[model samples]
Target: MKACIYPGSFDPITKGHMDIIGRARNLFPKVFVGVLNNPAKRNLFSVDKRIEMIRRAAAGMDGVEVVAFDGLLVELMKKLDCRIIIRGLRTGTDLELEQQLSVINGKLLPGAETVALLSKPETYFISSSAVRELIEFRADISDYVPKEVADMINGGNAK
Candidate 1:
């Protein structure tokens, strides 16, 4: 079966990220949303929390599962027996960074490839960092994230 890996910190899964996940699912038979666990990075939520949030956000989706990993993303892709890496591009800077990473991944692994998908117009302006910032200031984020995620962000009950 063809598989794709969509790896990210996912400090908090934003609506934009969900959009990419939804789109990736339609293309690849199996789409694994790999959440990166990097201690050095100042992530707002724990890896487990991030994974839970993703699971909650992806509750209704089939053939889409969330997993956590550390170290090189290509390694995780290989571990999952996937060759395609899904990335969401929302800006020029993202393109540049993604290009460099794609080149590096290609060199590191012969068969690995990166697929960049432009965000849907509605979610083009949304990002996890932006959502975190909004939450930090106690701004309403109902539209930027899933309701379960929003509740979790506000320290309220979340299923």
Candidate 2:
């Protein structure tokens, strides 16, 4: 079966990321949403919490699974037998960075390929950093993130 791995820190799982995942699900037979734990980045939610949030967001999506992992993403792709890596591009910078990452991943795993999807124009401006900024100001995050994430950031029942 054709499978793809979508990897990201997913610190809080934004709506923009979900949009890409929904589209990718339609394209691939099986899609694994891999929550990456980045040591260098400070996250409001722990890795396990992020995984649970993503899992709730992805519930009822057939052939979709939310998982967590550390270390090189290329290795996870190999372990999962994911030939395609799904990446979301929000701007020119995202494209450039994805290109660089794709090249590096390609070198690390010659069998892997990266497929990028541009974020929907309406959600193009949405990002994890932007979400965090909004949260800090107590701005409504319901529209920017899934209900679970919104609840978490808004001091409601998220778990």
Candidate 3:
């Protein structure tokens, strides 16, 4: 029962996110998509909506479970009994930040490891914030996010 956790805000699941989820699923028998419910951050969509969008986007991905969680990611990992954390790296900045988090997470939970996956070139430039900006301007975000997410944004379901 080897499993991994991919934690993120996932304000609205983007194609980049789906790509990482797909790739992670191929490596681990179970990949739990942990959607962080951060009360401090103002999100365009609710955590429940984000989970719903992720579930729809990853519908056919076996072993991929979408869940809402808060507090420390290490805590979530402990709760799920997982030791591997999957993170997507798009740029050097991401590498730096993720590296720091990885070290901290390892210290918090010994034996826990972080796996960094490079984003596909096609989705390297896409981000949840960028997608939100596009949505604010009423721009076409079909290419930036999953169809389910784009549809949700286009349908004005965003909070």
Q: Mind giving the per-residue lDDT tens digits that candidate 2 earns over 1-159?
A: 999999998878999989988999999989999998888878877888888888878887888888788899988888888879999998899899999999999999997899999888889988888887877787888888998777655665432
lDDT of 1 by residue, 5-116 (tens): 9999987899999999999999988899999999889888889989999999999999998999999988888788888999999999999999999999999878999999
lDDT score of residue 69 within candidate 2: 83
**Model 3 lDDT on a 0 to 1 scale:** 0.91
Clashing pairs in 3: none
Model 1 residue 33 CA deviation (Å) reads 0.5
TM-score of each: 0.95, 0.93, 0.97
Error of 2 at 82 (Å): 1.0
Against the correct fold, how does model 3 do in TM-score? 0.97
lDDT of 3 by residue, 113-138 (tens): 99999999999999999888888899
**Evaluation by TM-score, superior candidate among 1 and 2:** 1
Model 3 residue 118 CA deviation (Å) reads 0.4
Which residue pairs in candidate 1 collide? none
lDDT of 3 at 112: 94
lDDT of each: 0.90, 0.86, 0.91
